[model samples]
Target: MTAQKKCPVCGKPAEIEFRPFCSKRCADVDLGRWFNESYVVPEPIDPETVIADDGEGDETIH
Candidate 1:
């Protein structure tokens, strides 16, 4: 079984409706914060490696 986490924003129990967030407001806040650069995901991309691009110029690793 997996452990459940509490909502960090409101300190309330998380529900499935909002997932890791507690409510739609919280979810929207998170999204807005992300859009405003408040949150960032640290993903490492190798400069030497080239990503495969599809014909449409969309990159995907095969």
Candidate 2:
């Protein structure tokens, strides 16, 4: 049998609707961590890769 996926936050069995998270609460908690800057990328941002948006160009980053 395949092992069930667990939620990253609470170690609960992940649901299909929530994928990696067990419930909406867990998903919200993850989102809150991101919003609160509790989670972060370890790599430092490279200044050469950044684009300055002066609103003078039509190129959207996303």
Candidate 3:
């Protein structure tokens, strides 16, 4: 038998309609977290690899 997945918010068995979450409440809670910036997706940037324009009216950067 396959195991049921629990809701990430409430630890309850997930419903088919909600898939990963147990209900609309849990789903809304997750969405609220995103809107409130509780979750963040990070992008890393390297300064040495960055290109800066020298204002020579050219597309190439030094």
Candidate 4:
């Protein structure tokens, strides 16, 4: 037998429709985190490793 995964939001049993989430609310909550910039991957990009922007835009720090 296989164990079911719990919802990352509320630790409830995940529904098939929601997959990793228990419901649309939980799924939306997760998405909200992304939309609100609550989720981030702290990867220190070296300045030399970054490519310069070809478009007309303000200078961005690496």
- Tell me each candidate's RMSD, in Å, in order: 11.4, 10.7, 6.0, 8.9
Higher-scoring candidate on lDDT, 3 or 4? 4
For candidate 1, the C-alpha RMSD (Å) to the true structure equals 11.4
The residue-by-residue lDDT of candidate 3 on 1-62, one tens digit each, is 75799999999999989979999999999889888784454655667556554655866645
Off by over 4 Å in 1: 38-62
lDDT of each: 0.73, 0.85, 0.83, 0.85
lDDT string, candidate 1, 1-62, tens digits: 65666776787877777889888888888788778784565565766565544457635655
Kindly provide the TM-score of model 4 when superposed on the true structure, using C-alpha atoms.
Answer: 0.56
* Residues 13-62, model 2: lDDT tens digits: 99989978999999999989888785566677877667665678765656
lDDT of 4 by residue, 1-62 (tens): 55789999999999888989999999999999887775565777878668665777775755
What TM-score does prediction 2 earn? 0.55
User: What's the lDDT for residue 37 in model 1?
Assistant: 80
